[model samples]
Target chain A: MQALSFEQAPPPSVPIRFFLTAPLFMLLAGLLLLIDGEAVMASRWTPAALALTHLMTAGFMLQVMLGALFQLMPVAAGANLWRPSVLALPVHLLSAIGAVLLVAAFHHQIAWAYQLAVVAIGCSVLAFVPAGMLALSRPPGTSHSLIALRIALLAFFATVLAGATMALARAGLIDTGWLRFSSSHVALGLAGWGCVLVAAVGYLVVPMFQLTPAYPRWFARSFAPLMVLAIGLGMVVLHPTAWLPLIGLVALFASVTLDRQQRRRRAKLDATFRFWRFAMGCVLFACAGSVLMIFNIGGNAVALAVGVLAILGGFVSVISGMLYKIVPFILWLYLQPRVQGVPPMTRMLNEQWVLWHLRAHVAMIGAALLATLWWPAVYLVGSLMVVSAALLGGQLLRVVGRARAALRLAQPS
Target chain B: MTDRLPPIVVDARRLLPPEPMERTLEALDEMQPGQEVLLMIPRQPAPLFDMLHNNGYAYTVESQPDGVFHITIRQASGD
Candidate 1:
């Protein structure tokens, strides 16, 4: 076995900063929705709709996933990162700035914004992908999680490269046919990068936290590679039929996760558990919607609905739930040895507040689903999204604040 | 007669994260000199190994066929 070092685990600040900043992007998405709800709900191709989508995907999702990697790589996979705290600084700043600029570019159709966004986002990806790969080069063991994580990193690189090329094309900097590869870019980003990363981490956390049986070994081993292959095939075929297999694979993952969770030994169904259940259900719904779109059974509205279910309903919900557990656990671990009376991980954040956030989140998803059919409901969806984001951000601050207070008490005057 | 005591066995396979770490540290705290801790955990406790090493402990980790890790930790000589 490769020698492992817990001493290499970055300071909690590294991951915590990313986790805390993520919800602000969600808040920004909510604000954008409220301002341009009509245009956003009109069609997926609208500038406003594009901005809102990137705000969720590139802004919020990217932040949390990166942060989780900085933490999870060391603890779970024994992949020692070189000075994660130092690396996080540039990656976080550039990514957040790039995401904001990208949103601005989409919303205003600004050439300079698009160019700058590509440069900034490209740099951030460059900084991260190499460092991440180096760390994973020799993991302690060849667990399925590590293999999937490696594949996910490669997928992340491809996704960012495609996105950058597209951005430059949009900026009129390079006149190329890369613009026509939008579907491929989306496939690589959402399935190859997003879903695969989630599954990689899921292999460890699902069983560890939920006390469920380990994912079926065969499924765990094949899932990421198959996902990458399917995405590649879809990219090449450039046909809706090519996407069916990809969608089927996504649904399979969600169903298997839900099945495992069903047998969880935990007695208390906390907010995290409920959130995961809701997310899995949304994934199934999104897959059905995708099938409808593939068959041309529904119009542009169905496409929008699928995006809503997958991004907001599925990814956002699951990431938020993970943050609840990860943040508190990190804080508890940090403070335990230093402080005299560090609270249990469960008590770091108020459960009541989490439950309230869950309610808002569920309501927001419902409103968003309705908004697809009836435009007026977009206003309610925007409002509830704002509330949900604010609640999530507030709880994260509460967790940090509690940790700070405990640390201060331990300090010698 | 040898002064070394039988190693304390801590079956932390079922415990959640941090708990296993905490229990291992607690066991080390209570251990008399020359005693060892045989920690049985579901996965390799990578982080705990670093802590043990830093705090002047020596450990050997063996992985079982059934995916359990058997880690034997003791105070390093002259600590």
Candidate 2:
């Protein structure tokens, strides 16, 4: 049997930096939506809309995903990253800067912004991809989550490369045809990188968090790889309906997840459970919209609504839900030994704040979906976005503050 | 060489992470010839088993009905 080390979790600071920084980007995106509401709702190709979309996807969603990947890779797969804090700091900084510059480049069409974004994001990919792959390469066992993580990382690399190419094209350093790859790029980023990682982590956390039955072994093993193959073939075939099956797969996973929540051993419902269930429902609704769009039944507005559902409703919902649980858990885990009388993990954050955030988040998703059809609804969307981000960021910051206070009390003066 | 030696007992069920595994490894390091270490834990220490086996130790695990795991580790005979 191969030797494995599961005792290699990095210091809390490593992932915490990414988590604390993520919501600020969402807040920035919200501010942009407020200022450029009309322009953003006009069309997906509009510069404002493009910038806002990337802010959510690359800025907010990608930040959370990077943090979670570093934390999850070790525990879930026995794949410890070498010198995680050292490797993660520069990557996090560059990725955050890159996400901002990328959005600015889209908004202003500035060549310098695009060039800076290319360098910054490119360097981030350069640092993260090899480190991530190296971790996955040495897993002691071939668990489904491990396989899914491997696929997600590979997809992430491809997504970064494609995105960099498109940025260069926008900068006029390359020809116009790179825009043609946008559909395939979205497929790789959202469906490939986004879906696979969520599915993999969901399989691990859903059971642990809720004390529910494990996802069926065969389905867990097969779903992600099959989705990757489907996305790849869709790109190659360029068939109009080729991507439907991939969407269906995601919808199927969502159903399984919601079902698992219903059967949870712990009857007391928390804010996280509500967030996850809402996210899964949004995924199913998004799949229905996608099927309609694929069949040419709706206009560009319907298409835009589908993207909103996937990003905000599905990804943001789940990620925020997880932060409520994960942030407190990490603080408790690290602080327990140092502090003489640390609070229970459950007491780390007020449940009221999470409930408020969830309410705002649900409203934001609904308003964003409506705004796709009626441009005036952008006001509601933007306001809710601001409220939701503030609620999340403030809660997380308070947890960190409390942990710091506890640590200070633990110290001998 | 055949004299009976008492096994070192380490109860890890009440201890949290790193401490539980750390003390077990410490016991294993101090083990002398023909001596064994017995550990009581809430869950099977899966990672430690691989490390012990790879480092030329033999181990046995017995899971009790109450969900406690009793694990014994010794240097492989003749090592």
TM-score of 1: 0.89
lDDT of 1 by residue, A1-413 (tens): 22234455679999999999999999999999999999999999899999999999999999999999999888768788888888999999999999999999999999999999998989999999999999999866778888889988998899888888888888988976878878888888889989999998888777766667789989998999999889988888867899998999999999999999998766668788889889999999999999999999889889999999999889998998899988988887778667875666667779999999999999999999899999999999989989999999999999999999889889957
lDDT tens digits, residue span A17-124, model 2 = 999999998999899989999999898899999999999998999899999888888867878888998999988999999999999999999999999998998999
i-RMS for every candidate: 4.1, 8.1
- CAPRI-wise, candidate 2 is incorrect
Query: Candidate 1: which pairs clash?
Result: none
Candidate 1 docking: what grade?
acceptable
Query: Which 10-residue span in candidate 2 chain A carries the lowest summed lDDT?
Result: A1-10
| Candidate 2 Cα outliers beyond 4 Å, as residue runs | A1-6, B1-79
In candidate 2, the residue pairs with backbone N, CA or C atoms under 3 Å apart (3 or more residues apart, or in different chains) clash, namely none
Candidate 2 DockQ, CA atoms: 0.09
State the lDDT of candidate 1 residue by residue for B1-79, as single tens digits: 8766888889877676667887787798888888889999777666676667667888888899876789998878934
Q: Cα lDDT of all candidates, in order?
A: 0.87, 0.85
